[model samples]
Target: MAAPGFLEADGRNMSRATVLMLMAPFFALVIFAFLYPLANLLSISVLEPQPTLEHYQRVAENPVYARVLFRTLQIALLVSLLSLALSLPVAVLMANSRGPKAIFLTACILLPFWSSVLVRTAAWAILLQRNGIINQTLQFIGITDEPVRLLYTQGAVVVAMTHVLMPFMVLPIYGALRNIPADYSRAAAICGAGPLRTFWEVTLPLAMPGIIGGFILVFLTALGYFITPALLGSPQEMMIATLISQQMRENLDWPFAAALVGVLTLIVTVITLAFSKVFRFERMLGGRV
Candidate 1:
């Protein structure tokens, strides 16, 4: 009854419209639940009562806040470097191994992730305290006349965070290493390259992408870490998250707290974008994805 092909075309158009309608709720939910809340939080940095940049100015002007920010960066840098250093050999071994050895190594990397962060932090607190296992062992062996102060230190926070985050570094690097073709290394050897030379010239460059990705991931997480530092370190070692929490809950300063979060978010966003731009080589880094 309709014009030639017109009815079929109309039917196709109607189907497309129906599909779009079905997808609308999902889009709405994403905007409302995630994007909207993030936008609101960011707004707090500049928008209070009316709108002003005073909050950001205060953060920049305050020596204490500035010092904390620097400390945050320092801790993040150390954690990222340490995590990379520790993860590489483990990743290499995991990539090379098979059967039970591979399974055991992988399990070790994943075991800590099975436990809650709070539980891990608490465990460290007990183990690192003055009367804790390490101190007691030292005292028993006559290493010290008294239990040394191992807990409530920056070193303690760094150690706990490194232990907690080592897996993140390992998995990415391991995936990358495993994705590398064995033939490349074999070819290098056939070309009369020594073991160290082949690895340095071939494997290391290829593995760089994974290394950088893992570095960024560890750094970002360490930047935002709260529980380990809070539990293991003194007040002076407080990180940004702890500071934000103190401002919001203890001081009842939502705007300032939100501003702190906003600043941290900005720093992370900038770093991530920059890293992505500079390290498009991540795809070449093997299986880091």
Candidate 2:
């Protein structure tokens, strides 16, 4: 009895409602798994043990906590920068190359994703040991006669973290580079720009979004990184995450641990918002707001 247009409109409304129905589970999961837990933790930090800001105040006032936080930031920054430096040229190469080389390179980059982080950290532990391959290689190459104590240092932590986080940096950059048009490079060449000049001007600027994305990804992931650093780093290099775990599990100071978690969450939120404000994350991902 309804007009044809009216039936089509009804069908569209049903389709929209169906889509919402499909999405309902995902929203429910987020609420239960992420938001609810975070809210509970934050509330515990403030409300547990007679409702106090004392937990937060202790974290701020303690020099050890302050040092650990600062050290965590330092290590994260170092790993992010190192990953970016190593990723860019590889990303460019992957975007430009073809045949088996590209496939092989991509597999090499992606293969690590299939492995567990614990396994990777264990491998690094073996390789960087006093008599391990790297030290032996160094000895063979006359870099050092005896083992140089490489296993449990800040440098070792950064090296392992960079390797683990490198894929994150490379993939975003590769995606960004792949999205850039070939004509842009060609146009620069036609405009009498050399290869390096064209890259420095056209390619680099165009790829900034990806670079920024990769940097943030690597940086943020490195911030709370626990396994690699815990395995590789010494007590002197203990990061905020390590401290938080100790507080929660070893010390059994739930309220203080909750407070540390709150602080870390706040820092992460502020950094994420700051980065989003400074850069167009959607633009980098080739999308529009």
Candidate 3:
């Protein structure tokens, strides 16, 4: 018979092999669906037209591309901040409430997801139009002599994007807050900590993981947003996504577009790595790193 130690090691190896076998299909799908397309994009950026780096050079040289990229980053960051600020209170409410209140809050957050993004964006456009409900209300309340230019502006783009992405921020935060035991807060209170002090010292730190995760989700989504920005923003407010769309459709410059995508991909990868390092995400998720 095999030794006990050897038998246990063999069993562990078999389990590992079985797990890998089970995951093989998922790995294959990810490779074909995501990695293959991404590799093709990178190859096109340099390898097309006799392996020239002109597309990347052009992107580096062009101030216009830089401006669009900066604007995209700015908007994405702004949306993430706004979503975090708005989500905190709502998530807290959802976590603290019971029964009908929690259910209602959850339903409200989820209701928007049931509707299409285009429809939600269109609703914003209608509300923000020169003579639309918001402007009309402003005029009625004597806040302005004329209709304000709320639509086709950077603010409108930001606002609409924040509305659409708020759920992503809220849900993760709610999960984190919900997971926190009530006894933790009670323990803090018993230790002579006021509500504010308890929250500041205990709650916020514990919720950092969810906050970071939500911010990442919102920021990344905003980075590639197309419809809301296109519908609500002017040419001056064009983002990197709009620039890419323009290159692909109107300019028909596939190589240049691929270069743009490669740059964005690089930035995203860098940011993700930086956040992972700085935040120690595994620790946040209660894992040993």
Candidate 4:
């Protein structure tokens, strides 16, 4: 017969083992679906007819490819900034308001998410095209003598991307704001703090984790984006995604396209890791670590 304490310890160990057994399938799926495919793609970049540094050299040395990479970064930065700026106020309003106002705002935020991204991009293309609705409306109002070129421009691409990505920025910020306790602001007011001061000093700092999270999500997603830029942009505005497509489809260069994919993946992975580190720091400072 076992001592009571010895039996209790055995039961605890079995419970821990059971938990691991339950988690095994999830870990296996992640390895197979995510890591394996990514490893295969990265291999394509280097595994040529023979192992080569040539593709990476071509990407770095060629002015055209370098310019395209630079353009993609620029566009991603602009979209991320614009998305953050636009999302903040909407997030604040949703957090503060109640009743019908809150319901309407939340619905508006989620409306775009329910629709297909492809459909949204196509709609923007029609709206912004030279002979499309926006141009026609402007011409009809005598705002311009001619239909101004709007579609197939970098500006149009940014505008459409910002629209699609705005929801991503807003949701996280709202979550952060809602998590902030109400009494902190009330106590500040009681202590003679103005509303603006209280918000700036207390509310903003507390909600920063969410803001940073939203920024990273929007920035990374925008970086890998393909369809919006492809449809809404010109050759001069071509992003990395379009370049990869051109290589694979038109140039019939799978290895080179894979190299482009590898570069993009590396950049995104680094950015995500950096963001995760920053988030951990923020959480520690906020006492939530």
- Candidate 2: TM-score? 0.92
The TM-score ranking, best first, is 2, 3, 4, 1
Q: State how far residue 202 of model 3 sits from its true place (Å).
A: 0.9
| Predicted structure 3, TM vs. truth | 0.91
Q: lDDT at 103 for candidate 1?
A: 95
- The global Cα lDDT (0 to 1) of model 3 is 0.89
Residues 155-190 of candidate 3 have per-residue lDDT tens digits of 999999999999999987888887778888999999
- Candidate 3: worst-modelled 10 consecutive residues by lDDT: 280-289
Better of 2 and 4 by lDDT: 2
For model 2 the local lDDT of residue 104 reads 94
TM-score of each: 0.87, 0.92, 0.91, 0.89
Which pairs, if any, clash in model 3? none
Q: Relative to the true structure, how large is the alpha-carbon lDDT of every model?
A: 0.85, 0.89, 0.89, 0.87
Query: In order, what is each prediction's RMSD in angstroms?
Result: 5.5, 3.4, 3.8, 4.2
lDDT of 2: 0.89
For candidate 2, the clash count comes to 0
Instruction: Give candidate 2's error at residue 95 in angstroms.
Output: 0.3
Model 4: per-residue lDDT, tens digit, 1-289? 5334433455544454555777999999999999899788778878875799788989998999989988988998999999989999999999999999999999999999899999999999989988998999999999999999998999999999999999999988888888889999999999999999999999999988888878888888988899999999998879999999999999999888888988898889898787777676444222331
**Comparison by TM-score, 2 against 4, better one:** 2
Residue pairs in collision within model 4: none
Over 4 Å off, model 2: 1-22, 286-289
